[model samples]
Structures are given as C-alpha cells and as structure tokens.
Target: MPVPWPSGSICEAGVEQGIASKSRLVDVVLDESIGRSTPDVEHERAVAIFDLIEENRFCPVGDEGGGPYRLRLSLAESRLVFQVSREDGAAVVTHILSLTPFRRIVKDYFLICESYYQAIRSATPSQIEAIDMGRRGLHNEGSQTLMDRLAGKVEVDFDTARRLFTLICVLHWRG
Candidate 1:
C-alpha cells in the first residue's frame, strides 16, 4: 500500500533547516497506478526497495521537520512525482520531474540490461563481463540524471539515486 499524503505545508517551520538530522527514508511506496512488471522486474524492484530502505540519505531542501521520510513514487500524466512525508505521514514535499531528459538513457539502459541478461545464459565469462560493464555504465548515467533532476528539491547520495533509478526503470518496464 502507498503512504497517504495529507494536504498542508510541507514543514512545520517556514525555514529550511534541520536538513542535517540524518534525514533519510524509512519506507517507500510505488503508486499502484503504474503498470505491473514481469517477474524478473518485480524481483529487481523488491531488491531495490530493500536496499534503499536498508541504507539511504534523503533530505528535502527547506524542510524543517527532522525526519526519516516516507516516499511515494508515482507517475502522473507524463511526469514522475516524488511525494515525501514525515515518518508519521505528514506531507513534507512534492517534487515533479519531466521524463523528457530520461527517455534516451532509459531506452539504452533497457537495451543493455536485456543484453546483459541474455549474455548471462550462454555467453562466455568475458563476454558477460563486458555486457555487465556496459549495463553498469548506463545505470550510472541514469542515476546521475536522477540526481540532477532532484538537485534542489531533495538531497541524495549517488547510491540512493542509483537505487531510486532502478525503481524508476521498473516503473517503465513494458513487459
């Protein structure tokens, strides 16, 4: 189930402080409106969420509330939405980013991922390693794009953005 978001100010204080209270995410939810994925993709999604929950640093800019935030990721219309809230589920912030910049990277990542998976089955060790390297490169590119998009809206480390990117790719899977 998705975390419920209440309508109100994102923070109790009007100032942008407490960004250093070790702000992080304790839970995450993907909107049910997003299409379902294949079994492999579902497994990847679960692992990413697990990894994210295990370790992540997420601080929303200008949020005075010291938090372990609960995040709800969803796609609305053509935009990706980041709905953040306090651990108690009070609305903290909502950031919406365009999918335009991610189109090419995501497409290429999908292609590389397919190749990597295929290589794992029959290709030689060297071939699989090569494909896997390319996949990791594309993954890095996508993660960097995500960080850039969320720059001022939310503060996150490379690893956190990478895991979030993985979830975003899951949401994009067609099969």
Candidate 2:
C-alpha cells in the first residue's frame, strides 16, 4: 500500500525511508542580491534554469523531503547558498557551501568561456572548437567538484550538477 503523505507533501515513486523517487526542480530563482547580469549571462542563466526544470534528479540526502523542489541560488557572505523548499513553499534545506574551493575552477571556466565567445567571432572553426572543448572540460570539472562538495548533503546526477554549476558561475560573476 502507498504511504499517506502529509498535507502539501509531494509523493513520488519508491518513497522508502531514505530514497525520494526521481525528483527535479520545478522553479528556480536567482537571488536579486547578485544584481543585474549582462545579456550573455542572463541568457545562460535562462537556459540553465530551463534545462534543469525540464530534466533533473535532486533529493536532499537523509531527509524525507519530497519533490518537485523549489530552489533559490545566491551568494551571501562569500558563500554559495542553495535554498531548497517544498512545492508548497515550506523550507526543506539550506546548503551553504564555501566559495574558496570553487574559486580557481570558476576563474578558469570564465576565462575559457570568454575566449570561446571571442573565438566564435573571429577564430577559425578549428580554433573555435579547441576553445569550446576547453570550455566544456572546465565546465565538467566544475560540475564534478560541485557533486563532490554536495555529497552527503544532497544527491544529484551529473547533468543536474552541471546545470547547477552554471548557475553558480553566474552568481560568482557578480561576487
């Protein structure tokens, strides 16, 4: 028999003790504290949020929180804050990660991204592809780092971590 969920709780498949069935973020909001972003940054943010909402796997580790979740990403006091909440607007978990670990990778990723964007304008196809490859590599590294940092705090797939990393970069841009 299916377990009865409390009012405003979301129930998914396989809702056993520590497992929350497949989950995704239904709404993602960037904190206004980051200030306005450039058009390029804004576009990237939009795409990441869209892709994450369209497909993702996220569950709070060791918590009975259900999905879909509402997430707010922001930088506060030099830390990256992931404010997660239930669909009904009740808070679930708030994970504040240190930015020090991400500093170098994020810096490199931005540098490569700048090069990639510039390459798109004047570089040869081969050159552009090379820069793009580097950009992707850095992106992947950042995502992996994120997953590692979130380990035991929250559980997410690689693709979901990648998208979240992008948003983190966006936040880092202004910080």
Candidate 2 is scored at a TM of 0.81
Instruction: Pick out the ten consecutive residues of candidate 2 with the lowest summed lDDT.
Output: 1-10
Q: lDDT tens string, model 2, 8-100?
A: 333333344444434567889888866687888788778878987877777776555567789988878888889999888899899999989
Model 2: lDDT of residue 94: 99
lDDT of 1 by residue, 1-175 (tens): 2211112424313213444334679999888866667888788788889988887767787876568899998888889989999999999989999989898999999998888888888999999999888889999999999988987788776788888898888778776
- Backbone clash pairs for candidate 2 read none
Query: What are the Cα lDDT values of the candidates?
Result: 0.80, 0.78
Give the clashing pairs for model 1: none
Q: What would you estimate as the lDDT of candidate 1?
A: 0.80
Off by over 4 Å in 2: 1-22
Candidate of highest TM-score = 1
